[model samples]
Target: MRAGGTSELKQPSEEVQQLLETVKTELEEKMERKLDKFLLVSYKTQVVAGTNYFAKIDIGGEELVHLRVYKNLQGEVSLHSHQHPKTREEDIQYF
Candidate 1:
């Protein structure tokens, strides 16, 4: 599926895809908001010695706010978000 006006959606392994979907559903329900798009970024790090999966979300095509669902080594998952800086002088924060 296409997402966020970005490149075509990257296909993940079956296990990873299932995990991603679970995370997405939980986030949508817990936050009580619908995600308009999903962008997946996956890669392996030699130094870190594990795979990383991230689901970047876009809502309403504004690009002003976004959420990231991250799965790291040890099968730990976490959710974080970022928002565009309100002012040019302000720094962007990822959390």
Candidate 2:
């Protein structure tokens, strides 16, 4: 994807899973609860000083979350932000 442009939403790759795992603890802490499910629905990526990933995760049933995670040029991953209680019908975009 071009710098500053967001990529089309696509299936989560091994890289994306690893990124999520890197911040799983932080995520759970921010979420105020442990995740019972981690179904990745799709994700969009943007090129910046680092790369940004906007992901839609199915926590369970109709409940979902939108996550914005960043991977720096040095390849360190961090959770940037998140939106919770999303539905499957909601379009996953930059939040």
Tens digits of per-residue lDDT, candidate 1, 1-95, equal 12222233344455654665656666667557777754333311111233333333333354423334455677776654333323322322223
Q: Pick the candidate with the highest lDDT.
A: 2
Off by over 4 Å in 1: 1-9, 34-51, 56-67, 82-95
What do the candidate models score in CA lDDT, each in turn? Answer: 0.42, 0.85
**Cα displacement (Å) at residue 17, model 2:** 1.6
Query: The CA-based lDDT of model 2 is what?
Result: 0.85
Reference-based TM-score, model 2: 0.89
Task: Report clash pairs, candidate 1.
Answer: none
Candidate 2, superposed: residue stretches over 4 Å from native: 1-3
Error of 1 at 34 (Å): 6.5
lDDT of 1: 0.42
Name the candidate that leads on TM-score.
2
Count: clashes, candidate 2: 0
